[model samples]
Target: MKAPAISYWSLQLLLGWINFAMTAPMIYLYLGLPLVMRQQGWSGTAIGLFQLAGLPAVLKFVLAAPVDRWARDTAGYRRWSLVLLVGYAASLVALAGLDIGKTGFTTLFALAMLASLFGTWADAPVNALAIRCLPETERMRAGTIRSAASSLGAVFGGGAMLILHDRVGWSWPFFVLGVGLLLALVGLYLIRPVHLDTIATPKRSEVGVRQWVGYFASAQRRRWVVVLMLYFPFIGTAWVYLKPLLLDQGLPSGQVAVVAGLLGGVVGALGSLLGGYVTYRRGLHYALPGFAMLALVALAALSAALASHASLPLLTACTVLLALAMGASAGLVFGMMMYYTREGLTAVDYGLQSSLFVLTRTVVPMLAGLLLDHFGYLGMLSALMAGMLGIGYWSLRFVRGMGEMPPKMGRVA
Candidate 1:
């Protein structure tokens, strides 16, 4: 009945928010740019190709070994994250100067690609550090706080950027984002000084990729956890299908992007503040089940709204519901995943699961796009619904089963 106390909880939340704030530019810049270019007579396909540039994020697993091995002895992961923040912010400023209007589609896409690559480098250190710092029970609370931080960042970057750029001109988005990242770096520095020995004094055991792959393969009994990871992309892919649906319905692309960003990003961020509370009150067992219900109801409502020619109102409502489902799930599920990982395999387990999450987010969405091409939006939702229901059932069974497993490796990391 005792509450599990976390070390430096407030400081961790601050770091999480700042981390999210610092990293927002990576995706926000591209989210609005497509609509901006569309108005300037740029080909939509040309702008859409920008998605290809972020290929490095999913592949960060390959480079994660280097990140895991190479932090300065003095600062540990914090120093490394700071280094990435500096380089990433610098790339944002460079991106602003790239003559976005005059550059060929290929050239612009390349800059975006490089910027995202820098961001991939940044993301690895953050996640790795989080895995190392907090205990499993604390991860949900941390995730909730972190999700809120990132959600706020997304709102400012995605929602606020759309309106601001249109009225202020293109360069301002880059400028604002650069400043935001700089501030995040400052917040990061305030947490702890870079003292390598203090931060990374643990036993040195190199956990490599093959070992990581084997870990997952060995978790054969935990097959449903991996299955849940594979299913993660459907929701993301389903949402991606939403943008094109809105566009097809004759909504202004910028407005559509702005609305979705506000509802999904800002509202979702707000929703995540309750994530820790929800998990604490309802527990993870019910949290996953609840998200399944939310996703199904919201997606169906959104589908009906789309089919009926309802305007942005219906879209925004559906977006909020989906955002709620995502925020709660994001905060709880990831925390639960961390909870399930035993201490010895902490880094490798995270790396492998993260890779799976990213791979599906990328690949499933791409394949979903092809389906969108043939079946249109409605058919896409039909397919997504079927996949989600099946996966949700399997995931539910797994979560319940794990609760009954004999306690093993229950020590907090």
Candidate 2:
């Protein structure tokens, strides 16, 4: 029998909208902060310095294990989620004032850093909320919907920065964006999901920590761990340094966000929708390499763009392609992340493996930025292409089809 459904209703749609809005300001912050710095007479090094603000996400795994160990009572996931929502909203207000040009950049940067920490903390519980809400069979659908919503959020955030800054104001975007998150907080009340009586919580003893870490050390062949360690970092290659790369090519600030959302988010949504269907129908085999190739092609186009001094039209085409590739790849990677890790132990049993996945995502992308800064865009894109080639090689050794693993433990989620 198929697992239970999340039941499409007002709550889920509201959740989608609110999450998008709550996240919108930061997304703008990431894009706009650098532009603000550049215009403020700051150097690229200073702008790149802001990325260190994301360090909490990389290290949240240490905290994630503790979160996994305790599942709240009464409200279950909702209880913790509400706390995170409040913290996140308040941070949005502080973020509006982060004039990196001012004397207290370190202090403002700390606030920005806190926002990422809270956001990732919120992500852990919300992901659990998804596990509670959707069945395995329909998760691809759920992921597709979630990603599309996120893409829409990106579009809205990006578009606001692009079009509205001229007329409304720079900080004005924060007001609307902050309200978006606040609305999401209200959305939880509307969800009213049946309490997950069978909800998975880590054992509060040594057994829990052992089990959590034990999965990585499993004797299955060590290949799965290798896969996770080796290739996942490469997944972020194309857009890793995209903003800096674009600005270096001379795209205007507002246009950078507008095109990123229009092409990256809107076009990306279409790509994700199509990818979800393919993943649901065919399995990971077709899904992984197909998306990987799309990314590889996008990289080739980017190399050509940079080599040609970033012809505007060529760069625009590159942006859309990269966005679509990333959209589909999001499904491929996360879908695989879910399938490979928890099904054997049971979905709710995801407490251990799930946290590791989250940890890696946070760590890997942070590393991507550093690597991008060192290598320059073209050099990093080339390295990313190499990363894709590695995944392609690894996939050949391990995958049998969707939901099937060749008996070697040689897969990465």
Candidate 3:
């Protein structure tokens, strides 16, 4: 007898948990590390440069082909995820031992990069599994759920961990992260193995680099890719810098962790769920620009607050608004990306798309760091606001034309 169908809600909840687990390590590096480094009296340039530690994320696409190729018989994606998740968790434990003073920053960077790299390896199969499991009808909601889970992960990795680190030291957060990953591993064991035969598994030879690149050769695909690439840079960079901005603005470290990290994360998580609903009702094309415009407004308000050296009440209000808009935008964009991933080349296609997103998410923040040092907080805010406004306008024109292309444009053989 055939197995019973997994309920849509069950799949969402399971995948959401996995996504939350996957993102926690990233939060430690991206959100948690900057604060730690800054407190250690690291310069903006140094903290900004550490963003390169996420280089593995950008390069994960290059490794996707092998990940997709190997481990097919060993429950394929599940096998890969199992090994990598444990390894990543161990790396976090390793981090707990290191001292990240100016002298040991390189050691810390190397280990952090390794942990992130392992996380990326684990992520490749998870993305493939998500594509294989979700029916086209449920893809949008799946994206939203994944985004919400990611926000929660950020709260754990970025917010709560920061609080823990502030109250105690670095070791507690890292140990807790390892423990969390191991717990997630147990959850992964509970899910039924995905049947690869259900997907349109293209023969290995058919899905080549040339064909993969060719997927975006169409005019519409190119335009849509451009929108995905540009959308996150300005606002994303702002979010990356926002914590340090709060610290610089005279907020105590603990308060900054609560206001900018935890509270913002909670608001962002809720917004992601809401954004998913909006995307379901109005379609992602409508949701993208609408969310972008909201973010633009929030960034403008933030710029005004920065000008006045705003009090905690004003700063907290702006941070909350910005997080809400950003979380929603991220959810909508993630949902939009899911629609473009093809059946056979799910890992490669998703990896390529995600690499582009990570490219901007990683690179622009480095520039923002430089801008912060050279231009002061207000100047940096002004620059980001202008860029966000320009991109928001440009996105509406291009995103409207999305999904209008031939059905086969982004698919595998």
Instruction: State which candidate has the highest lDDT.
Output: 3
Question: Measured by C-alpha RMSD in angstroms, how accurate is candidate 2?
Answer: 4.9
Off by over 4 Å in 2: 1-15, 38-46, 72-74, 97-103, 158-171, 195-212, 219-235, 242-258, 304-312, 340-379, 401-413
For each candidate, what is the lDDT? 0.66, 0.62, 0.77
Please say which candidate is ahead in TM-score: 2 or 3: 3
Pairs that collide, model 3: none
Candidate 3 Cα deviation (angstroms), residue 4: 9.1
lDDT of 2 by residue, 223-314 (tens): 55545444445555456567668888898966776666466778877777788887767666666666777777877888888988967787
Better of 1 and 2 by lDDT: 1
TM-scores, in order shown?
A: 0.84, 0.78, 0.85
Pull out the clashing pairs in model 2.
none
Instruction: Please provide, for model 3 over 1-413, each residue's C-alpha lDDT reduced to its tens digit, 9 standing for 90 to 100.
Output: 22344655776788788888879879888877897888899889888778778788887777677766664332577778788888899899899887665446688778888898888878878767766766665676777788888889988887778778889987888888888788878876766554334455555544568856876877776877877787767877778788888998989988987887789888988988998887667765667778888888988999899888889999999999988888887886787677665545667777788898888876787788888899887788888878877778877877556544323211210
For candidate 1, what is the total of clashing residue pairs?
A: 4
TM-score of candidate 1 on Cα atoms, chains taken together: 0.84
In model 3, what lDDT does residue 328 have? Answer: 86
Order of candidates by lDDT, top first? 3, 1, 2
Candidate 3: regions farther than 4 A off: 1-6, 33-51, 71-75, 96-109, 163-171, 193-200, 206-208, 308-310, 403-413
After superposition on all C-alphas, the RMSD of every candidate to the true structure, in Å, is 4.0, 4.9, 4.1
